[model samples]
Each structure stands twice: as C-alpha cells, then as structure tokens.
Target chain A: MFDTQSANFDVQGLSVALIQAELGRREGGIPIGSALISPLDPDVGTEEVPASGRIYIHGHGRNQRLQKSSAILHAEMDALEKAGRLAPEVYKKATMFTTLRFASYVHKCMCTGAILLYGIPRVVIGENTNFKGEEDLLRSRGVEVVVLDNQRCKELMREFIRYHPEEWDEDVGGSKETSARAS
Target chain B: MFDTQSANFDVQGLSVALIQAELGRREGGIPIGSALISPLDPDVGTEEVPASGRIYIHGHGRNQRLQKSSAILHAEMDALEKAGRLAPEVYKKATMFTTLRFASYVHKCMCTGAILLYGIPRVVIGENTNFKGEEDLLRSRGVEVVVLDNQRCKELMREFIRYHPEEWDEDVGGSKETSARAS
Candidate 1:
C-alpha cells in the first residue's frame, strides 16, 4: 500500500514486494520517508477492528505533502464516521473535498533530486508543454522509454531491465551496466 | 536496460534483492523470453565471445519486423567492427540508429487488457504514460490505493489480529500463529 491508488488495481501480491524494496533500502541507514495513508478512499472502512490500524499513501513533492495532509484529514473523518465516533452533523459539515494539482516547483525539484541522487530511471508523464521539459531532464541523464507494447510480456520485459540492470543488459539487453555507463 | 536509453545510465552497487523484488521473483525458473545480441546498437564492436553469453531480442510485431531484423544484423556487424573482424566502411554504412516506439493500437490494447484481467489495485506505466486508465475499474474492485498502503505495513504488525485478514495474511512475521498459518 505504498500508494493509495495502487490498492484499486490488481496488485496480485506485488504490492508488498514493491513496498519492501522501496522503503527497506537506505543510503546511510536513514529511512527515506514514511508511507502516508489516505482516508477519503472507500476501502478504509471495510475491515476496521482497531483504533490504530491505518492505511498509507505515497507522495513526494509539495503537492504530495498537500495530498498527504488531505488524506490524513480525510482518514480522520472516515475513522470517526466508521466508528460512529462523530456527530452526523459534524461529519456532514466536514465533507468538503479539495483536489490539488501537482505543484510545479515541487515536481521540478523532486524529480531533479531523484535523478541527481539515485540516477534511478523514472517514467515521465505530462502534456505537450511539460513533456519536453520532463523528457529533456530524464533524457539528459539517459532515461527514456524505448518500447511500449500491447503484450504483458513485453511490458514485463521492459520493467525487468529497468529494475534489474545486472541480471539483464544495462542497455544492450536491458541491464544496469547501461545505467552505470550513463551515470 | 529494460529500455534502450537505460543502457546509458549508471546503476551500480544496487541490491539484487531490490531488483528481484521489483522486477519479479526468480523462483528458480527459466525466463519467459530470450535475449539476443543485436548489431543495431553502437555498443557491439567485434569482441570474441561465446554464444551462450549473447542475448536475443525478438521481433514480435509486424510493423517493426524489418527494423528489428536489421537491428540484430547491425549489432553483429558492430561486434565484428569492435573486434577488428569487419572493415571501417561497414561501420560507417551499418551504423543506423533505431529507437523503439509502441504503436497506439498496441498501447491501448495493453492498458485495456491489464484492466480487464487484473482489475484495479494495479497501476501500469508505459514509456509514455502513467496512471493511464481504468481508474473506474479499480474503484469497482474495492482495492483503493489507501488500502494497498495499509497492506504494505500489515506484515510488520501481523501480531495484531485485525491488521491481516485470516486468509490473505502470511507468515513473514514470526509469531506463534505462524505455525498454524504455515500449516
């Protein structure tokens, strides 16, 4: 449950591994960041048995921070509503939802920070205006999408090389040596 | 190296566990697809090597069949050039650059297939798109991102009864219940 949106997909048991791989790795033994939980989501109330058991969501920039905070408040209201812990009127009054767009500054800074720090490859997404900037940022560092296929096998193949460069070719065969060379 | 551009990146000293967790479990099985050494890439230049060490790249689709075929031929030529097995004119003539792109039909099909088969609780990204589609599909599955995030940490707190459902939770965390669960 590293990201709340992930839950709505068919995790097929991969979610746990994704979380472990991300959070367990450390540079200097410092945890990167804790996973954030979202309460506004519908699944939060389905299986509640404890006051402390909470869900988490993943976020990074200023927008992510805003999203995380929003999630927290949403969750609190959810918890209250589920437990019959809040007055109906109060819960109704608190039902306002705010949608926050990704902040430009934060996106630029964090995306740059990720590239600078890890040289890790990321899949860039945006409209025509931002696409070039994002693509340039990633491409300058030697990251770009080389294939998009209809088959799951092809997608998995691409992901394999992206995640495991050593076992595969860094570039020639989708391996990490390519990343090493680029870095 | 999942993508051609990754061949230029620097990814060294990263963990194998992290790679395995991210890419997919090994489970001691042969990979589904084969890897081949292609001559289209600039990396190959006539290095004497055993056939077993070489990788294969398949040409699955119709549109790019010729390019894919040519790429392999080009890689072989490059290998020869680097190894001093081929003449300089060959290098100048064969050095054709090719970048892979997924056709729109294929891209759409893949996204659609993932949704129909896996449902939500899964997020997919192509070289160009992230959070692409099927948000509504995920909503129907009751998978929500928040729940997935909660599931991410559920293992650490498995000692608590409520954190994991009796059926879905596993024995990664050592507990007295582990025995029964394993059984």
Candidate 2:
C-alpha cells in the first residue's frame, strides 16, 4: 500500500518508519521502527524509478513478552531479518532508515555488525542522541549515516517512555531491592 | 563438567564464558560468548554457596547463516534467550559474564535493554573497549558491571577477525562495487 514508485526514497522510508513506530506503540511494544529499502540500480536512471528495482521492508521493536525467546526485539534487527528473507542478493545494497538514535555500545556493535555483515551502504536516523564517534565509526566503515529530525517520531518515543515509567526509571539503585522482592 | 561448587563465582563464570566462546569458534560462528548465573538466595549465605541456590546458563554468538531468521545473534542475546526458557522466575537475579568488550551502541542498547527488562543485577566483561558513558548508564540503572581482562578470550576474538577479514575491514568503500558485481 506504499508508494514504491517514488524516486524520493528517503521520504518514503521515513513515512514507513513512522507508521511502524506507531504500530509498535499500539501493540504495547517499544516505539522504535526501521525501514530498509533495497538498492536502486545505477543503470536504471534516477528519473523514473521502477517499483521492481527496489523493495521496502519495515519493522517495529517488540516487547520481551511478545517475543518467543523473551529477548528484546530491536526495530533494526526485525527489519534486517525480513530483508534478508525477502532479498538476500540485494540486501547488502540496502539503505536502512531507523526511528531512534542509538546511544549505547550494545546497540552499536550488534546493529553495526549486522549492517556491515550484510554490507548495507547507508543509514538514516530520526534525530541525534549525542552520538559519540558512532557516526564516525560507521563512516569509516563506508556507511553513509544521516540524522534527520522528525517531530512525530520524537513524540511517539516520548509517549512510550511515559507509559513505561518503571522500565525507564533512572533511580535504579534504590529500586533494586524492591524489584528483587517483587520478583 | 564445570566445577560449579567453586565459591569464587567470577572464576567459574569466566571459565564458562571462555568455553562458550571457544565453542562458537569451533562451530564456525562469532567467537563472542556469554554466561548467565542466576542469583544466589540472600539467605543462603555466601560462605558456603549451595548449588541449588544458583543456576548457570551459557551461550555463544551464531552466524547469520545459521539463524532461521538470518539475524546476527549476539552472545548476550543468546544467553538471555536460553535463561528465559530455562528459568523465568529467577532470571531477574541473573549475573551475566561475557567474553567481549562491546564498542558500539547497537550491542549496548540491545543487550542493556534486555538486562534491564529482566532486572538482572550484575554484568562482567572480559575487557574495556574505550566505553563512552555506556557503563555509567548501566550503573545508573542499578546494574553492577566489572571488567576483567582475559588473554585466551582476546586471542579467540583476534583469530575470528583474522579469519574473517572482509567482515571487519574498515575500508568498506572500495569493496561495495566489488560485492555488488559478485552478487
């Protein structure tokens, strides 16, 4: 149902990412989303982009309860899995669009490792989260990284955190015993 | 068979983490590995730790080719998944031991998110990879983290990178076209 024929891949990809984030919120999951677009052929000419030349795969982060393995399912990982299944050959040429800015090494290593393994060439994120050399690392590895701020995507993440106060609480030291007792 | 009776939990946990890393290397996967030990009951007394008071679960990173969904499975995620299935009740009290030092946010966010969600209290890594505030984030969330360097674990990871040079190559720009042509 998406406009696959659009030459503006970024526009289409961001729209898909936003929709997926909203869907995740509605499904009681993390409000993070990713959209991966298969590479466009250089020989095809950029004027009239053919729908067949590109594939769109979108995914949203899932809560631990919704996962069969009870592991946190990340939006980028979900989209990457789907892309791998749908198109392995052109997957490496894919451009990934994500709704959140990564701020931790765990997320950077895991997702960057996958992106590099699959040879994804470009990544677009919604806003910056004080990225510290992560963008440089990606660039060094030949990944074109872009940060494009989106108001709606920011609002969705804010809402998700608002709803899940316990999960995001920073006063974790005082609550450790409480959590242990509750468990 | 591991000596689970050892009162030194760190020694036992590190040994398990190392073994898992070796297993991954032998299985043609990533050399990273993780071990999760369920918390010892507070009343059990630390001097003579009972076997029934704790549980150990270990896992290794898997290659994308080995996965049904083609997702790159991190050692931490693998261990977390197994712990969730084996013992959901006491999983919150788990202490995670990992063979590698994470250097990216992808790994940090994914692994940290799961740890927080499960209410895991402690984490131990083999070394530090110039972590930038990620450790602080974890500590702020009430997680205790320790870095204990190990020679064999470092050797295993080095060998993994040596064997898979293309995967870790920093000059990814020149190879993009070549990869596209080969595909």
Candidate 3:
C-alpha cells in the first residue's frame, strides 16, 4: 500500500506510504469477511483473478512509473490473469485510489519523521524483488535483520551471559534506617 | 484535539474520509466548496453545519469525556469535524470501520501501555479549555508531557542535537565519528 511508482510520484512534495492491515475475528479484530482487493495493471486486454493468494513486491525509481511493494500486489495481478478479468477501467481507478490513500499516510510519516533507534524504523525499498531479495536489499541499506541461525544465536546468548553483571541491587534493605535499627 | 473533560474519554482515530476530501479538491489548498459539517452525539441527536470563516473544530464527546494526551487522536477528530460533520450513527460506523481496519496498529500501541504520537504534522490543534484538568490528572498518573515548558523543549532539542551530532560535526571534528550522518 505504501509503495509509489514513478508515474504517481509527487511532482511536488515527496511522500511515502505505510500500509497497515489487521486480520482477526473478534471484538478487537476485523471479522473474517471479504476484503476489497484491487488487481494490478488493469489495463486493456488484461484478465481478472482472485486477490487472495501469493504476494508481490513492486518498485519504481524517481522517473519510473507505478511502484508497488508487497507480495499481495503481484498476487492480485496473477489473480486477474487467472480469472480472465476484463475490468481494466475499474483496475486503473482502484490503482489510483490505493496510491492516493497510501501516499497520504506515507507523506504524514515522512514529513514528521519519528525518533527511533536508527533512522526511523521504516520499510525501505531498495529494489523490488522476492522476499529474500527484499530482505537482502534492506540489510544492504543498513537495516537490521534477524536471521534464525542456531549457532549464531547460541553464540550471542553466550556472549550476553559472559557480560552479565554479578552485582544485583533491589530495594530489599531499608537503607540507612534499617541498618541503624539492626545495629 | 488532545483535551480532557471530567473522566469519560473521546478518542478520535484518523479518518480516510477527511483525507480524501482535503486532498481530492481541485482548489488544492484553497477552501473546499461547502464543507459538510455534522454535529452528532453518540448518545443522541444529529445536526449538519456548513463551512464558514476559517476551519473550526466542533464536536462533542457526550458527557464530559475528553481526555488529556499529546496523541493525535483528538486532532484527527477535530479535523474531521472541521471538514465535514458526521451524523452520530455515521460517525460511529466510520469509527468502527477504522478500528477494525487498523486493529493491529491500535493493539500494538495500546498493548505497550505508552502514550502514542502519530498523525499529520503541521496540524495545530487550537488550545482547548477541556484539556487543562485532564492534563493535571495525566501528570498525576506519571505520564510525561515531553514538551511542557521551554526548559523541557530545550532539553529535547539538545537530545535531538546529540542524536544527529554528525550534522553538527560536518564542519570540524569533535565527536564526528561517533555521530552517524543523517540522510
């Protein structure tokens, strides 16, 4: 939802979008139901497909057109093709709608950057690719990535244990007053 | 929009409707044509008002239900009120829509039990009387109002300065390497 391809880029002010979604069926979550998912590139001579499986990640440079990030966008396009969809006009409208909506949130985030440990924790897009490529690109851009490696994880735990302090201080004793009473 | 009156709280979530109206205008930054204002009570009654003069904030939280916080919920609510008035039923439905849609985000922030700060910047919420008592109550509850006075503001600026030391270090040396450059 947050990716902006060059075509929709603000010729004026730059902006970023952060897509947020929730899936649940309870008092505090969305009731399981249909979600309005838009097909990717609903241009003429395109097919329509269900937008519920797989994922997609798309990107565009400053001059590139229509940037998308997320496995979902691709799946939508695939769905359209598989379903032989013909709603090119509707798809185009949906694309613009999503872009504008996402851009608004992104603009808000970028304009008022939040304080974070290392540059605001952001979903950065270096090059749109598969999950692994995306992860690598983000890491290359100085983003921290946690990989599940048993040995490495164990080493980290060991190092942490080595540096653990022995001295412990809790408010157990009543301080000077308690010491005096004891004496 | 961050204000407090008595105990019952009036929390406002960001609204997509407002964003669409504000940015979807042909006038760009000019006043939108005939703003739709609605005065709706969650408890009872509904009235629609029109745009006049500068954008104004007008909404009720039923009884004394505004709470004091630096969060953007109230500001967003005020923005919606200024842009278009929603009938109580419509407002409630919209609120539900947002809550369900962004439940995960809300849950994550709420779970941390920490005050949240998020929304469009450069949006100034007018000084409100309803917030005074609520702020006092919040201080008593150990919530830190980070920018309460000049001294605190200065301290915060210094902290940011420290965090972005490389920006300052670009000239000579002194703690240059220790500070990472800002983008």
For A1-183, candidate 2 gives per-residue lDDT tens digits of: 434456666767877877777877777766677877764442333254445644545333422323343343467766755543433335455677888765311222345555654567788887554343343555676678877878887787667556664443211212444323222
Best by DockQ: 2
Query: Residues B1-183, candidate 2, lDDT per residue (tens digit)?
Result: 333455667767877878877877777766677877764442233254445644545343432323333343557767755544333234455678888755322222345555654567788887554233343556776778877878887787667666765443221212434223222
Cα lDDT tens digits for candidate 1, B5-63: 34321121011112322221132111011111222333344353323332223111111
The i-RMS of every model, in angstroms, reads 23.8, 7.4, 21.6
Question: Distance from true position, residue B31, model 3, in Å?
Answer: 31
- Ranked by DockQ from best down, the candidates are 2, 1, 3
Model 3 lDDT tens row, B72-106: 12222223323232222333222210111111122
Best by TM-score: 2
Query: Taking the tens digit of each residue's C-alpha lDDT, what string does model 3 give over A116-175?
Result: 111212222221111221113223434332222223223322332244211000000112
Ranked by TM-score, top first: 2, 3, 1
Candidate 1 residues A50-135, lDDT tens each?
A: 23333323221111111221111111122221222211112111211111101111212222222222222322221122122222
Evaluate all candidate structures by whole-model CA lDDT and list the values in order.
0.22, 0.56, 0.21
